[model samples]
Target: MPPDSDSPLPTDAELQILRVLWSRGPSTVRDVLEALDGDQGYTTVLKHLQIMFDKGLATRDESGRAHVYAPATGEADTQRRLVEDLRDRAFGGSPETLVMRAISSEDVTEEELSKIRALLEEADGEKDDASSA
Candidate 1:
């Protein structure tokens, strides 16, 4: 049976395809295969696209032999959903804990912290606007 409408988050392979579609726009299996530098063959990419379509994570145009595929959702939407799922599953739904853990990582740079602060300020402004509405 095909996947349900509320299917689980994309697998790593599917996320790779989504990243390609997001970066390059709609593309065919061959396009994605060429873009990805992994050992996965053409058929593997084809199967991944098909599965993504079934799972409602991707859409395809079959008017031509080489069907063009694109992500059903935007990059931010997918990222938000993935992060929410991770927060729930691994962080006990505590976003503060998640953010603290993430920021504590050595890979996070000062520039990234500044960006995060800016985003938090923006979010606070939005919340204030919504409350006054």
Candidate 2:
């Protein structure tokens, strides 16, 4: 399903569950619990899923005996939303500030730097195209 852009961002715990759902696809509560290494009890995970559904962060299927749950948003969409929020709130809406801080804060590998450069090039190309139009 397309992401609900208005939906609130997931909490840390909810993000963990979403990561499992994103990786494993729609799965039962038990499947999610197992994927999380059973760190939290089954009931805990189940409750989180219920809350996620209410918050529109996840979708629940009740066709089978065990309800299957899936992420309401794709990983990339969620990541983008999160970064945008962070940029707006903490970086005064400056994406360049956010990106510069992020790159400086982490131990990014050469390959990742290459990828970032490529993305910058692509974005620059789009900007150039827009200016000529």
Give the Cα-based TM-score of candidate 2 against the true structure.
0.92
Q: Any runs in candidate 2 off by more than 4 Å, and if so which?
A: 1-3
- Residue 92, candidate 1: alpha-carbon lDDT: 100
lDDT of 2 by residue, 4-108 (tens): 768789999999999999999999999999999969999999999999999989999999999999999889999999999999999999998999998885698
Angstrom error at residue 25, model 2: 0.6
Candidate 1's C-alpha lDDT?
0.90
Model 2: ten consecutive residues of lowest lDDT? 1-10
* Cα-based TM-score, every candidate: 0.89, 0.92
Best by TM-score: 2
What TM-score does structure 1 among the candidates reach?
0.89
